[model samples]
Target chain A: MKKLFTGVCVAAALSLSGQAALADVLDDIAERGVLRVGVKADYPPYGYLDEAGNIVGIEPALAQDVADLLGVELELIPVVSSNRMQFLEQGRIDLMIATMTDRNDRREVVQIVDPNYYSSGTNILAPTAAGLTEWEQLDGLPVCGIQGAFYNRKTEEEFGAEIVAFTGTAEALAALQQGTCVAFVYDDSFLISRLSEPEWADYEMPLQTIDDAPWGLAVALGEDRFAELMSGMIVNWHLSGRILALETEYGVDNTPFAERMHQLFLDINPSIER
Target chain B: MDGIEAWFLDLYHTTGINLTIVYDAFDRERFLWGLLNTVILSVICLVFSVIIGIIGAWLLGARHAIPRRIVQAYVQFFRNTPPLVQMYFFFFALGPMFMTTVERHVGQMVFVSETPLLTSFHWAVISLSFFAGAFNVEIFRSGIEAVPRSTIEAAEALGMSRWQIYRDVILPLAFRICLPALNNNLVNLVKTTTLAYAIAVPELLYMSNQIWSDSVNVPEMMTVLLFVYVGLVAILVFAMQRWERAMKLPGFGR
Candidate 1:
């Protein structure tokens, strides 16, 4: 019985040590010489499929920048809102830069590194003629949005707006364009990029951002070193003006979070490093 | 390793069967709501499809050739094309035109979702009814044909009118003969309501997706979804068996 107990103890120790070896995600990526990032291929301006069928967007570009900084090749794994976290937890990807919002509830399953890379919030894009400049004014109005969005139920309950949710962004936006709803409620960052286009010129963002959330890169639980590495790279990008430049390159408007992070990064690291 | 090679290896590692996540991720309210929507959608589709089927069968049995041909064309067109494609065509292409005419007459838009004139619910019903109604036409026709020619001749000899013969002799017999096919069609229709989630109907499948996304428990949510569908289909089959027993013909399918 004593010998059997000792054998069990030895086996447990070996398995625990094996798990510890897999915990250092940063070391794993460095050794592999490739940073696999899960990013969105459906969302535009942040991440999307280009006309050439290649993944091209702001998030993909940021991930590429991270890969370059680490001297590793970038491998982008396309993910949607539904499976991004699972991809991280299961080690399918080393990092998640798929426009994942940092919510407290999500912290249970994955680790979201902060000094967030970017920020966006739910907002309404209405016809300029409607003059809906405030959230309260949406009362009794039918508003269109994508289904399964966290904000859909909130807007309905809080603002008295009727929500007409669609499965796709294209359909939801088309619904707003065709006057199926008085306004289209969606992520402000996406609307900022879309409103720049000629077709969407007639519509205007009428309200300030609601449900403000920061987009952060996430890693599997127990990968603190990897999260630290990611957060540090993000801060360096902000200080070096790379994030602002990437925004311009991608033709997306910079969020307040980016501007503030840049200011903070400059104040702390005043010395010139180009 | 190459990017594709790395991705495939990692995918293989991560996608292993894990059922614990389902227990961790289950949300009763979300699941219940999804089940409710699915039930509502299926019930609506079933009722309307049956009505359309009956009407279509009557039209197909019409004395006039053009009317019968038209009914035949509807059955042929719907049955030949895939249900998914028909749904898309109706929702995207024909839905707006129909809504435009409706709005023009009503002097206001009756539904929201700027692109579709009808709500996803209405479109689900409309598209599903037409799809199922097509098959129902054929099913009912086969049942009507299975009614004995000698029985019809006997009714005619008894000085029965065409309407009386159809109401008394043909329809009742056809109904009994068609019960099994009707049951099968209904079961298929109930299962097909899952597709409505693609159009953002917030049915069971859509709600499960939302829950899994929110909870990050794909395995758990998926397990729950599997059981929900199995339970639904089982319930339907059981109910149908009971119904079949109750409506059994005297000497049929012993």
Candidate 2:
């Protein structure tokens, strides 16, 4: 029994050391000829599954192009909003191309790539029946939103809105549809995507856009080489007119916000080949 | 008073949006729906886990050593791993098998849609039930062992069958002893339902995340969410304590 126990302990220690000695994620990906990217599989036009069950969207398309430039295959790994950071840190994915906003807290933990692609702002959606025309109109009214969203405290402190927070977009939408809240608060891009759906056509934007936040790709912290590679891919994509092509393909150019976003992208990186 | 004024003043200086935005977002309908989901998930998992636990305890407590050892190993494996890992494995690894099984067995009976097998909600319940069930087995087994062996022997001597002895004496006594621990498990199961958010079940935490991601005021939103969760869990703990007290056996504590 003692000998068997010693053998088991030695085996366990070897396995632990072996795991510790594994190559850095970026190096491994370069050698393997594939970049495993963590992306949202639900958010439409950015990172979502198409009707044929294929993962095809703006982020996935961009990730594929980057992989091609690096001579690697793009392996899209579906990740939800909650676990995306954890996935990156654990080396489950080489990098994240989800619609992740640039925040200080996140920057502390992950490396944010330069030249963010899109700009988004917070906005509120109200049912046509609510007739809420201004922010103050929401005072004393029940508003439905998701938890962990950045606006719950601001909405309460600034507007005295009674916030009912749920866990996901589906629940918030369901609440709005079911007349639980007169309005629902979310990101402008998300609102546009949701409203474009057949089910949400009846809903309209009631509140003006709040803070305009930039979105960027994130890799593991301290991985400066990987960050540089990612930023270079993004810059090359811009110069190659690939970003513009995506905008035209998605018809995002139709929206004023997308036009504004396009201009911002150009402002940040003016040397695009387009 | 000074802090309150400063808070309000800061809000006015910064965003120009008033407190109404909070009220506007508080949809009673959605919150109630979330509450309903929470209760439904908790109750169903609770009942199923108890059933599993009872069976597991019986198997583990049996006279045969080999089978008992096997059951012991099963309990140790599950109980030792983190619940989140188990949830992920079940959702990502085993989900397809369960989905196919549900579609094959219950799809035609329940819904008109072809892909009607195993909705996200069903998967959430199953994952939580199995995770909780593993722990329940250990708790119930311990409770059963705590029962005096003399009582079971006396029932058997009175010509009562094994099943009758279990049903009349052992089960009641074991159940009473297990009440406090069982209450803690139930409360825990309720909180664990939040894991359903990862699979996009539209629970409370998922919605909050969507909101914060949009708003850019993560600290404020997170603080409120912390309070909301704390309040919800506290209420569950209080109610469970009451139930535990109600089920307390006389003369036992003294």
Candidate 3:
């Protein structure tokens, strides 16, 4: 039994090493004429399956643009937030346009492409009647939020609000609707999308953006060439206003944060013309 | 072809398998701390639930019908309801009330790292104890009943008081008979400690999830979680088996 196990381990390790050293991803994609991209199939206005089962959203559209730029067929591989990076690192997808937030910790394992595609920030989603006008007003009030969110600890300490965190955003929203908390604290872009739904019409974003986190595309580690190419493509998109056009087409809120990022991208990339 | 290797390969994508992600993302200190928290939570819950079980079992033997029914209701309600729902009820519904009461008395909200850690951890312990205690009640009761009635009669005939008969005679014998069931309950209690992560208790699973999110290596992190739990449960089972052998009442389990 032990010998057989050792043999299999050797085989697996050999295959993994062989696969890693085999080819450059950009060249592989170019040679194959296919760009497989992992995209969220559940989050709306970012990436979600339409009524016809087509993957349609801002992220998927951006993935299509990437494939178009590469002059290859786009294969949309549906991915959730949890499994998207694994899919990228394991070579299941060439790129990840899955609404992944750029953070220093994630940068160690996955190469997050520079020139963020979009910006999101933590905000308070409160009932319109609550009149929660400022951040300090949350002091001593109960706030519901999803567990494991980056802003959970910050919201707790900075605002002095008692956080009632749940395992998912759905539960957090439900708790807020049921008045378990004075407000639901989550990403501003997600809350903005939620506010458009008739069910969530009564909820209003009361506080301005607290902590802005940019969303970036992720590639496997050691894919420096692929990362630089993708990053440059995003910069070009920002300079040409393609990103803002997609935002309008997808009904994403044209927040001031995004506008400023656009200006910054144009300012930095003077060699690229609109 | 072997079982372990096949299982390991199934954890990754079929085209290529990389275990480096696991090696790279592994945080020895954080994982050790998480393991410690899990062990501490499980031990605390096990101790409290055993206490609740013994008290509950004794009360269940009461002559009065009302108290027996109350104990019966507690055992029934807790054992039947999902532990996850019970966790939410305690964390969401009762947690704020507890904080308010504390604040009312102290004139300020007590916090650690900007949140009420004590209150949340308190609720996590309370929920787990009550949940497991319900099952332990039945286990203990059956253990007590399995004790030969002739032994109790023998202690009574020796002019032993009720408390004496229970403590010196009945309880010791009952524990011997119930050792296997009690060990099973303790193992289950260890497994259920993962549920504490849902309430953000920073136990093993919660910390592992934090690492996985930060690293974006779900497969690697999940493998770590699975092995950590398996190791924990194995240690508990091994310890219990050793203790059972040491305390083996000859011919009792046989």
Candidate 4:
């Protein structure tokens, strides 16, 4: 047993030492002259398409920061909630700034940096006529949801909602408009963005939001050097009040989480200029 | 029961292999329900498709040219176009037309209307049954053509009415002749039930997708889904084969 264990350790050490030079993505991003980042192409205020068909949003801008840090050109790869982590794991993208929820299961698959970048809670986009005032009001009624949202099961199980999850926001919105579902249970941030539009004028986010979860940006697992670099960047972003500025620039309401994070970072290092 | 659930949870914790259906009660119940829904959907579509096939193929021999032309158009339209588009048309374009407008309050989001006469599930059934029926019509047509004119003439000469002749003589033989093709088409229809996921029917694929998305156990749930579908299709094939054998010509051997 000792011989077998030692043999396996020797093999692991040899493989690890042999590939040590190629392991650090922080250096590779600099050497490659292009940093590939996964960003949501359809989610507004995070990462989405501009009228000119270019990918623009807060997340893409953050990705550009990483590229700038490495002194490399930025390349944004469009990803949906479902495939973003897989893309990072497959090494198709060196970094991921998509609006992914930080969960223990997800952390097992991808190296989510400490100090999350953003947060959103679950809420319902219901017609004003629906008069939905409480989470319990969703019981037994059909609620449209994006397929990959983390809170879909929660809404169904806790509130007894019959979730009709669709593959995209467009389809779910159509279902909501068609009255196939009385409400759409989705991220409050995205719902708030939609409410600003003239098309969603009559709908209100009626219920109190629930299940608030912070969003984490991630790199592929074992990219510890890159993860460490991103940790510092998140701290810098908080200290500089960059998140708040981006919220204003992107027309999002300044969230309490952002304010708290900024204050917390200031306490840690009060000398940084806002 | 708790032990089994705990075992699955422990399995997930140790191996980093999460299978929510086995461990989570809500997911397991829903997954089972999803499987049942798929079975119900496939059976309903299969029965309806066969009925449509038999009727439409028989209509091809109608004394009126208009009936024949109508059948021709239906087959062509359904066969040439996509089922997914047809489902969307039925659900989005045609469905809302039947929905009565509720009290129009202010602006857009309050545009809540009642459910249409046909739900998404009903639309899926209509779309898929017709889609498979179109192919079935052609299949049954060829099966009908293979029936000898002599036997049909004998039945006609023996004072069988047009309806009786069709009911007794043509249908049974044509059905037997087309059993293999019908089996193939029914199996395809069963597989096509997955398309209902797009319209949010909560079939096996949709429910499994829900589980995977929430649990972040894509590979594990996917494996489960694959095997369940394979098992479902195998059951279908077994039943069809038995039906074919039982209905075989008395002295015939495969």
Residues A61-90 of candidate 1 have per-residue lDDT tens digits of 889988886789999999999989999889
lDDT of 2 by residue, A209-248 (tens): 7777888899898876566666656654554567768756
Candidate 2 local lDDT, residue B43: 78
- Write the residue-wise lDDT of candidate 3 on B83-171 in tens digits: 98898888777664433322211114332212333455678899999999999989999989998889999999999998898789888
Across residues B1-254, which tens digit of lDDT does each residue of candidate 1 receive?
Answer: 35555564465459953332223223555567778999998888888898888889888888999989999889889899987777766666666675442121111223222344586678888889888988888888888889999999999999999889888999888988998899899989988888877556778887777666655668867787888788988898899889878888788645
Q: Which lDDT values do the candidates have, in the order given?
A: 0.77, 0.70, 0.77, 0.85
Q: Give the lDDT of residue B10 in candidate 3.
A: 62
Indicate the residue-level lDDT of A1 in model 1.
30
In candidate 1, which residue ranges exceed 4 Å CA deviation?
Answer: A1-117, A135-143, A147-164, A183-185, A210-254, A262-274, B1-30, B99-117, B252-254
DockQ of each: 0.13, 0.10, 0.07, 0.24
Reference-based lDDT, residue B97, model 3: 49
**Pairing residues by index, what is the TM-score of model 2?**
0.47
Q: Model 3: runs farther than 4 Å from truth?
A: A1-165, A173-185, A193-254, A258-274, B1-27, B101-118, B251-253
Candidate 1, B60: how far from true, in Å?
Answer: 1.9
Best by DockQ: 4
Q: How far out, in Å, is residue A136 in model 2?
A: 29
lDDT score, candidate 2, position A96: 93
Candidate 1's docking class is incorrect
**Interface RMSD per candidate (angstroms):** 6.1, 13.0, 8.1, 5.0
